[model samples]
Target: MFDPQTQDQPLPQRLTRTLIIGAVVILVAIGGFTLIRDQFTEEEPPPPEPSAAPSPQATAQPTAPAGGDNLAQVDDWFPHSRTEFAEAGGVAADFAADVATIDYTRDDWDSHAERLGQWATDPYAVTLTTADGVAEGIWRALANDADAWTGSADVVEVTYFDPTSVTIVVQVQAEPDTGEDPTDLGEFSVDLTTNEGPGWRVDRAELLR
Candidate 1:
């Protein structure tokens, strides 16, 4: 009975402990894998970006000129100039219409005003009768705005009733003030006889309004 070889071995305590520890490790691994399965299976794609739109406003353009407003303007030139005889020769008699147009700020505006004033009274009155004769001659010479100058006022026509007598056409516009529409204010026939000059200026105008 006492033979060591024949003895019932007391359960190997160390071996039993090792087997229990291995069983615990296997159970923990199984639980962790079960919990992680759902996370590994699910997938979500990212969102897309938005697009931009275009603008609205349009581009700009230039303006055009008025019709025969030019004729209306020239219609004013003849009589306006008739008031002054001194500077009324070359440029005045020629195609000098643009005074109100191209020459507005150019040329001697003072001269224009001075001559215009003289036509009414003052030192200019000395030659009143002669001036009137010249103006009348111009009035008789020119008929209407149409016969005078067109477009840019590049032309003019004058007719003499007698050697020293003439008739001219004139137009007036109440512009830069009341309205854009121009009015044919009046046409005039001036009479004058002067020893100083054949064509003096309009001493006085006979309103043919």
Candidate 2:
């Protein structure tokens, strides 16, 4: 459908007008196709942000045991194995309990001292058996009173430690047969020598009260 006036134009002019209209039509069609594609085609999801790296967890520190000879509680035992530490702690605890407990009615102080001697050095053993020694004094005093007492000990902690020595603090509880409240003998600091004399023997012991 050509216009009569357009038909009458010169051949070059008519050709130019026809070409321009075709170009406009093509441009319009291309724009419409782009709009339709944008409407139907889902936009790709934005790239997921990389997750933050997990934070490093903190390392846990070693903790001391509440009581008993837990070998794991021994941190430093240079020149000695953990077995030695456990043995030393056990010997101190036993000595503390026995020394603080007495039964005057049974007349067993000699036997008790004999047992304790196994854990002491020769000189200390003599001290325990001597008439004027601390053990004898304790035995006589309790026997005179005719009172029986029992004791128990808990290894509170190791206060000092070295290559050949360690100091342990024990909590002693002495209860009398009269049924009164148990007496707290306070903390006993028992110093022991590992390399000298017997393997882990008490060198000296004193109350820290």
Worst 10 residues of 2 by lDDT: 137-146
Q: Each prediction's Cα lDDT score?
A: 0.39, 0.77
Listed in order, each prediction's TM-score against the native is 0.26, 0.53
Q: How would you encode candidate 2's per-residue C-alpha lDDT over 38-63 as one tens digit per residue?
A: 98897989999999999999989878
lDDT tens readout by residue for model 1, 1-209: 58988587776889999989999999999888877986787676666666566676677666556564586567454543443332333222221122122122332434434444343334334432343433323323332322221112221234333444343433322122223343333343343323235345433334455
Q: Identify the candidate with maximal lDDT.
A: 2
Global local distance difference test of model 1: 0.39
RMSD of 2: 11.0
Please state the error at residue 103 of candidate 2 in Å. Answer: 1.2
Q: After aligning candidate 2 to the native by TM-score, how far in Å is the CA of 176 from where it should be?
A: 2.0
Off by over 4 Å in 1: 1-160, 192-194
* Angstrom error at residue 159, model 1: 7.0
